[model samples]
Target: MSSIWRTMRGIIAATALLATGLGTVALPAQAQKVLHRGNGAEPETLDPAKSSGVPESWLQYDLFDGLIMPDGKGGFFPAAAEKWDISPDGRVYTFHLRRNAKWSDGTPVTAQDWVFSWRRLVDPRTMADYAYFLWQVKNAQDITLGRKAPDTMGVRAVDDYTFEVTLASPTPHFVTMLHHHSTYALSKANVEKFGADFVKPGNLVTNGAYMLAEAVPQSHIKMVKNPHHYDAANTRIDTVFYYPTENQEAELKRFRAGELHFTYEVPVSQMQWLRENMPAELHTAPYFGTYYYAPNLTREPWKSSKDLRLALNLAVDRDILVDKINQRGEIPAYSFVPPNTTNYTQQIPDYARWTQAQRDAKAKELFAKAGYGPGGKPLELEILYNTQENHRKVAIAVASMWQQKLGIKVTLNNQEWKVFLSTRDEKKFKDITRHGWIGDYNDANNFLELLRGDIGKQNPSAFADPQFDLLMAEANTTSDTAKRATLLQQAERLMIEEMAVMPLHFYSSRHMVSPKLIGWVDNLQDHHPSRFLDVKP
Candidate 1:
């Protein structure tokens, strides 16, 4: 670890030299308008279609412009496509591209770029895990399944400035989906020139408010204002430094020392300290996300023993987990969807209504029925989680609950962010593992789709229910927003009732934001694009 850290530091130093005209070329630095932030993890990739996790989103949102951009509030505003028209049937969408919009290289951003990028995302060869998002587009699913060609995937460049799209059904949230990274346009010429290395700092060509200046792996990602951005005149903060500091305590120390302008998370244990000492800097709000643990259903115990799964789910004391252990303002979640999601009602499980004593009794009854008990060979399992201090605390606390209440033996395993991502994607974990989901859009379908068996590896639990799949399909096909919402609610309830995964708590964004940073607001998404912010100069 020490050697790795040293190497990362060396790389950062070399990149800084390149940025300061020590290498191939010289670029002027204007006024040193820089914002330093502490990020939770290093991004594994910058490719929009393949990227997942919050760390990647931080960079992607700045480096590329989609047709529409999320406002951090519930609504979306125009980006590359300034205006668009939807057919009365809601199946066809015609987008009018911004003629003045240009890439970092000063070339016009044509509609062909968007068509090419969207087709690449849904193409089977790309294997983008988020390709399921394109299922709304006509022939997109067929193309991804290898039954149709990419050219036939319902996206067409009508002219240099006109792009046309056709959806399989009337999707109310289709515009919301356009704001996601998966729908961002990529520079086809640059992608072809660099191939797999297209996202490297010097090779990247972006059309957003900022473009990649330098990227040092595991150390920092530096971005500068994009000269060719349509709204470049309004893009404040000439440079943004994203430091991947996963340890919350370490991040707090940096923030206290005035080295960081903002941090992505605050340690739960330090909440009281922050409140008492630096109350003005601390901020909190309900975020549209969930923290849960998924049992690997392909293996033994979890796959064969439904009674055992129920017992384990009932064993958790979410009230204690949130109120005592977490101490943050997170809501204890009984359902997959959170309470504040738009257009849908959150379901409350019957077990959630039970008292702690009642839950304990029910767990014990289920355990005994599953043929595992205190005396005759206690059930042994391990909980896998990413290496975060807060996750460790929660794991230990939950482990204690299982041991004390059900007399089950539990072991804990930890991995870093990159390894954990692969482990979850490849289905290599043995038993239950820690997992979380943040909605891509403010819709119930985004959360419920994770469990759809048709998604393949995205459903880490490998859970499959034909009835649930049918309900979701029906919901997607109908144009009635009310009926669609009802179906989604039913689907979410079905998922929670079966105990496919243990829902721990709905998340709250706890962080420290310097008062000097202007235009920052607390929203349910907790997404504040750097383009909207400026340091008090």
Candidate 2:
């Protein structure tokens, strides 16, 4: 804890206005009953289907409710839909919508709203990054690929209060998929009437516990309780405020100074300090995420160089990188799948368990096989990463190791968040760039699908092994849990051996929580919607 910032109450009070200086006026502290928390960064977009970042999720989960929502445990509870039933074959699901559910504008939330949202998501014009998530639905892939019309999507409105979904196969995780933000219902009237302004304060009509009151980019967002929400009476917090705090240290300072009630992340450097001073406030939970670097397989040099890719993956000392650079309780990732993933058992490659010297020898052998040697010719490649203190340190360390071990000249490139996302998505980077995949659902398919050939633009690495694709397809359609896990594990092993992407570390959710906060429970997903939380006076 930074006690110095806590003591400087006068400075905090003076800068309060300046800190929130975008285009909106901050509500007077005395008049507003609001819970304030730190959002990781400026939201790229608020459109649930189109948005693809963590910051947006923090707000979206509160602004809208899907058919199902996480219950602060691994299991899920109904949100918009009161209950649902599945057929014996598991191909069809019938959702029973709550009759009292209404949008923020007091209009009845009907089954048609969900149908409209699902069609909009799979429409090619929307260019939703997570559209692949709907592939399990009947004709969803063909619809998104432009072969079929969006209306042909599997979701249908049986009536105003009845909704049905048809799947291409018996997907065990289909219900859990409804918990994602992309599956939330959208207001057809509001979207058409407001156009791009539909998400704005007055234009937006949501059905969650809170509605977007105001949003000032790069500054803050204010959400007030929605009177029309079915369960709004249970929402203890009348209002909630989210601040964009990219710098973890600055976020911690704000939390200490009473400017923020909670933070999604804390700087790794200050973890020890927080544990020593405020152990109860520091919360760490297992997260389903993988941090890796995706090498551009469509570009030259790397496009034809398999041995070079192997050498690079082998040279990385993940243990050292995780301990010294990212000391935030992250585990060095030898495989993409993290521990305790649903149904799947972790598999570590033989090379990952080898001694440092043994791995170096193998890397040298691979480089030599590729006709590149330390004295003969120097191999050069550029590593691109987003602008973060920890990322930079890790990149530098990895570069130094490559230089010393393989005599490869490595250059580091840094890009801002939005730019980095564009560069990676556009596949315009020269060599390799930093990448990460947080599970959309509690299934291995979410991570494994990234390497699939038909995954669209998200497959930046351009890795398409026919064998790997076949295994993934089999795993998707397989209903037997144990057999499905085997197939998925085999696909993962193939991906690792091919070095499609270099898995650096597995993440853990490390956040600063206020003691006054209530209704927070650490879960595997690490999701805590503001609607479920209340602040103590």
Candidate 3:
């Protein structure tokens, strides 16, 4: 931090360059503020309209600016939009864009860009898992289903700088949802010119603090500061490199070797070792997400066998899995929604009060009833998860438990992130696949909507109970807080009773951050943008 230390460090760096015979030492120059980050997986896409996973959001949030952006306090504040107004009924919102806001190409970012991007989001022709996120908007669902025109889907450019949106009904958390990548605006001109290839590094015109510099599948993504960004003058991080380190152990090694300033996740396998050795670098905080296994209900007994579903769901010891495997301070999940969600009551499962022995006994009884235990034929189930060390450990533990207690064979299948995503969606009886869903916002609706009886890729369980769907629909229409909470609670209970998806553990962010990295604040959503971070000497 002292000027003398900085000068000495520069001399040491110059001496090292001379020692290596790379080049002659010259006048010192300003250091480039670059951050090498260990991203968990390769991003599926850079296009905001089609991005589905956290890895993709990490890049998209840096390259695109929505009307609002995360204020890093578990809430949103104006970004592209300078200010906004809401109607008294809260059914409509109008955002006033900054006249100075410009894309990476120096073109003005207008309200029309948002209108076009939103229309594409709900348009059936454009494939995206999060398209249904905008279903609360008036006619958005109808447009998605091709029952209405795209222009009729409730958003419009009132002028070059003013964007207006209308919802079918009042949504209290709608503004909060605007910070998600699915709601970010894109340049219509850029998309129209290059079509689907507009997201390529040389073609993309980003509006956020960074622009795509290079992209290599499975290797790394490079981004540099955008000079034309609205707040470019204040942006600190000049360059960022995101390495797809799905292997948590390898990622931690890279962090220890000083290759990465930060990591997406610290390997749970190395939790104790990290705590003992690098206590200052280890950053763990409560995260708004849930890890679970979704059964492929489109195939075999899973479609009709409630007993089979319940047996498998009740068999897993969530307590042991959380306490033993994930020592990163995660809570056992008995419900789909994470605990402490804003204004939402936690939905406890029916078997929550039962002892582990009682649950196991019940699971054995149900497995036998479903024709799979002592009396019936053997059942072999395969659990598919991405190639992450934590996932593998959890799968091996669960398989071992099932083999020991229930007298059934369990197979573990591991695939790369992209392949695993595609394989899980294949309509076959893949049995079960490991999945994690981080909340887009603080509302319980954000968590519950993943199971909505729709044909979207987000609904991996293929759960389509008409009664359960009705409860969620009613909750959507209910404006009163107490009534809505009751409706959502009933819906969550219904899903658990039916064993639609097996609940695992609620997430806690586990990252290893360098002490030199300043302005890295922890929040419920676990969102930390590179623009806000600065490095010290």
Candidate 4:
């Protein structure tokens, strides 16, 4: 017994030495709680300005934090900015940086760093898709449009630690808008020194809970806790490993094998099995997002044919999509906006209430009017979707429905995430595309603004309407809550009537969490940042 005890003590002492001395060595979970998370796809870029996907956003949440972080209760708390103040009119905001907040290079995070980052986000050279988000800030849109110089924008560094922002209008949700990853500050010195290569793992200077220790494409991305992080002493998980798991079945297998602590999403086909077997681990709840199929309206033959767009939308069997394919409690979506949006009502179109048979008949009639039917040109098209098993299943099911019901010839085109985004953004695809948008903020504008003409790459459907835009613009800036709601409803009704997209279903987040993982709480946003998650020792 005395010899065994001595051996155990030596082993424990050596393990401690390895953890401290070998910085990149991954320690056992018993000694250091490491989280292995299964991400859905390979992240396109870690550069916050160039990222537009959920996978990249998840990494950003840990690798970089903005002025304030969401508190998960429809509120926020200070992050890089230790405290803040708002003006009486709510148009101006002031942020006080934490004195202890330092970048990975041991440099203090100053207010000037934020100004440079914000200006770069809207600069035309950067080509950031989320640039529309900052239009609320004074002169931000002008700078983005090249009408004004970058430094002329509203954000200013009052001092080394003080940052002030003046908005174009009294935006009540302006502070909420600041919580997005796009607003996260990048070190000016680092960018000036490294240029485009700054995003490389070794060159990146992060100011969050974790730093990019290594990234291996299609395999795993390894991140270690940042010693310079303001709250590093309080952070629970010492290391995080994210795996690119596009295959749901394979991800589930790994989970059962105890290789993964969490899954990005569960396979819909295995919903029943998960419920019966991993009831405690299988979590399904309402998510603030919508899944839809959009037609490219930029060029023919979809360009001059509104009837064709309406016909395609009517032919879709949304009920089957929700109840059959995605059976994890997803709601059949009719409007572009999710009904979960606070204090807002979804504008359900007239065709939504019609039975499948009724919709099919109407679709046939519309197809005939649009110069396609049994005696006319044969209707054929393709749907482009990113590489995912669930998306493939949905494309196959929906194609069958169109072919059998409306005699429309349909084909499916699948591409990896990065390629698919480029195809969709460039409007290179001739037919329909499957797209999903998870809300960034709780407000209705967060979802509705995607269809705006000036939204850049996000507006893949080419939905441009002056009246719709006018209504939304007023709704976006109005201080009167009642008037804003009315305007938003009008814009949505108009867009739905115009057939901007075929709404399939509202997403219900279905993920598997290991029992060993703690501090897990379900939320509508479906955001679980690493700082709040922990692994049991």
Candidate 5:
């Protein structure tokens, strides 16, 4: 039998055996004793600088310790650094490292490890997409842009246990940024010993509560408690097994069979069935993410006419899309900035809102103004979506809606997730592309600043505007919360007016966890299976 089939059979046999002979293996008093997480994609890499996908990042958090860590309440707390001091000018930050911290290999972790990691991230040779995250560090941008050498980075090891960093400006989210995996320290010894293979499963050394014990590409990964961790006592789980299963049905079957403990990104079609049948274990959270369609503004047709873009934007029925197509808990989005971000207030005007009649009238008017009307001149557009079954369903639904509402013909192209990401970044195919962005930090700027003309180059679509860029720049420097919110709101308005991107919905993640699992907190932004917090019975 195939390995997958064998595994499935093994799970069934184990459950039956447990019921028949409870005395063979002592059952713990608590409910769940192990956490089995399932994901759709396998991690690409474990190296913090090279990792990009959610799986890799989530795993990195378990195997590495950052200077700061998120407290699961949208705030920062010390991790490797026991405490810190900020200069009155908000330019310099001094961190006091825990003297007892040690790497998994038993070597003491030092301030120099952090300095090395920071310098490596900004190195041009690294080609790290997340390098921009370090822009707040003094001379980091210059180093990344090749204007300054990597050696000139503004981090210094004051001593074996002290580190100092200089920032170019007062970044309000500076402390939070430290919690990101990109800011985590790497062992120099491991890097030299393993060379380019430093991040390979067996060759890795971690400083966090858990250490990577096994990695089976495209299959599963397993982690065990790290005895060398500073706070190992708080880590209750002995081992964590993560399986990569792309099919939601398969995941559900495994969960029901007691082979898996938890699964996320629940299939929209199964939400009703799970809600009714498994209501006790179902969990949902409003995620800080935006699903949108991107138009290749650098390409033809979409390039010359802003009216056509606005017309297409207005044609999308976000309410219907979120309610019908995205049955898996999603909020219809009217703006890019998700609600509840820091400094956000409901008083901020929502520029994307318009009455149904007004939207239809405006769409019709723009279509006619652009020399195209219903059945007059059919605009042939290609829409790209990932091969995930739910995403394909959404794409087909949206395509049909556009054809029926605006007489536009859209061809849907579904590709594997990895290929889809590459093609989108290359800007090679399709006029419209489906994409989503989950917040990196709980800040409105993270969403609004991504649309800046220069920054848009990093994004898939080539949409840009000088006015929007200026507003984003001003918001970054403005310390006053109200003033900054105003500037960000203005920038959001510009995006809506131009219709450079169409906001579809604010995603809400749904999942099922075994009743046995405890201390598993739900985080919208960073949805990692936090092993340290979970206690298995």
Candidate 6:
């Protein structure tokens, strides 16, 4: 009986060791499989040409192929195109396609698709708000403005697989721009098949690693792997589910309940608990963007006095807001462009550099200058803020500060995001509106270019300056990086000096992920998760 017991123990020990070895063994040829992703918002549209939201853009990247795509490490790589070349004058670009690439429909992807997609984007009839992104392409502005026909636009199909494009100038970032969803290709057949309903989940065709399996408006969206994809071997995930919960607390709850694989915006209130319990799961990255108060410069009281704007800018304590209201990892911003952005220099001069006490004094002096003071003539203004808790808290804090320091009565108006955007677009808000601008790319041009009256005129801010416009134009055309940086820095200084917009804080996003997830990296330029690169258990 003792001999039998010893034999049994030895057999069990050997089996356990063998199992451990198999678990750790590396396979040279077999590809790892499947990843599941959770999103905080439902995609508005899957059609690459129309999708503008971050969630939509993320899914679009996996469903469609662009001429070029960012590798999430600062460089652009060919996607549909196997190779590309630039002309000596930098006016023309030619793309060569890979022979193996094909659409999910099994049709050969041709240059004609590229030509059609480009023309469609710039067509005034399409009314693509994002068409401005393609301005570097030759004749794009002309096509958008109805000055030229779509065919006259400088993109053409040289052959079934070769595409050619002409640019108005030597844009070094042109390839990087192509990586954006605005440059994604769409099939003419799919467009015709679904017509206006092409973006509908069931009706759409995918050329990416996954296809939209289901999408319920404002609720959830699910995507399943595309077996017909060109690189199916690399695509591990069978399905991805997106839940559009706006509440940060609710997202964290779902994450803790094991219902969500990841949550992007962890609530500031839970930061301490998360740090103490699961520090390894927490991730943070500087978002290349700014949150600011866009004063309606074209309207009454605010428009009448530059000092009033300067006073208001000085009155708001950015440090307090960052530390108290937004406990999330946000940096106090003194300038429009976030630090570390390409072509950005910290040399830009800040206008309102007053300390807390000095700021209060300045606010009082400005109120008195405007013919209003504490217990005297009351200056009542409505400050608009988003419905988000953090935004509302910041608004309340600013409102309280104005009341306490400047003796101004500020009424806080909180609205849902969609309504707030619509109200701002209508330009009906004559006082001030809170807004945030997340960078579309890694360039300072993303933030700096928005302030240009040419772009802002359509959505005009209350303030406009010819000098600022001229400086930006000079910077835009100059190929020399140092010269352009200097010009942009000068323009930023002038903007802050003029009190054009009250710069508040630059965002830093935090995420909580399950231990099972891996290969995910935080992108500072855009917070959207790179679904293609991440792997899950």
Question: By descending TM-score, how would the candidates be arranged?
Answer: 3, 4, 1, 2, 5, 6
lDDT of each residue in 1-537, candidate 3, tens digit only: 434346657977876778578555444466667788888988878888887889888887788788788865566778988988989998999999999999899999998999999999999999767789999999999988889999898999999999999999988878888889998888899999999899998999999999999998888899999999878878888889899989888888888777788999988878998899889999898999999989988888788999988887788898899889788899988899998797888989768789988889999999998888776988888989988999999999888878888987889899987778878766443788898999988888888887888747888688888888899888988789998989988988888888889888999998999988888888889888888888886
Give the TM-scores of the predictions, in the order they appear: 0.93, 0.92, 0.94, 0.94, 0.90, 0.87
Better of 3 and 5 by TM-score: 3
lDDT per residue (tens digit) for residues 420-508 in model 2: 88888888888988887788787888888899988877885989899999999999898999999999999999998888888989988
Cα lDDT over the full model 6: 0.73
Model 6, poorest ten-residue lDDT window?
27-36
- For candidate 5, the 10 contiguous residues with the lowest summed lDDT are 345-354
Cα deviation of 191, candidate 1, in Å: 0.9
Compared with the true structure, what per-residue lDDT tens digits does model 1 show for residues 122-211?
Answer: 998998888889899999989999999999988899999999999998888898888788889999898999999999988989989899
lDDT winner between 5 and 6, please give it. 5
Instruction: For candidate 1, report its TM-score.
Output: 0.93
Q: Model 6, 34-71: lDDT tens per residue?
A: 34345545554576776555666767777777777656
CA lDDT, candidate 3, residue 41:
87
lDDT for residue 27 in candidate 1, whole number 0-100: 52
Residue pairs with colliding backbones in model 4 are none
Which one wins by TM-score: 2 or 5? 2
**Superposition error at 208 for model 1 (Å):** 0.7
Residue 394, candidate 2: Cα error in Å is 2.0
- Candidate models: Cα lDDT each: 0.87, 0.85, 0.86, 0.87, 0.78, 0.73
lDDT of 5 by residue, 415-489 (tens): 776677677766776699997878878888877766766552346577778888899878877667788889888
Residues 155-182, candidate 4: write the lDDT tens digits.
Answer: 9999999999988888877777777889
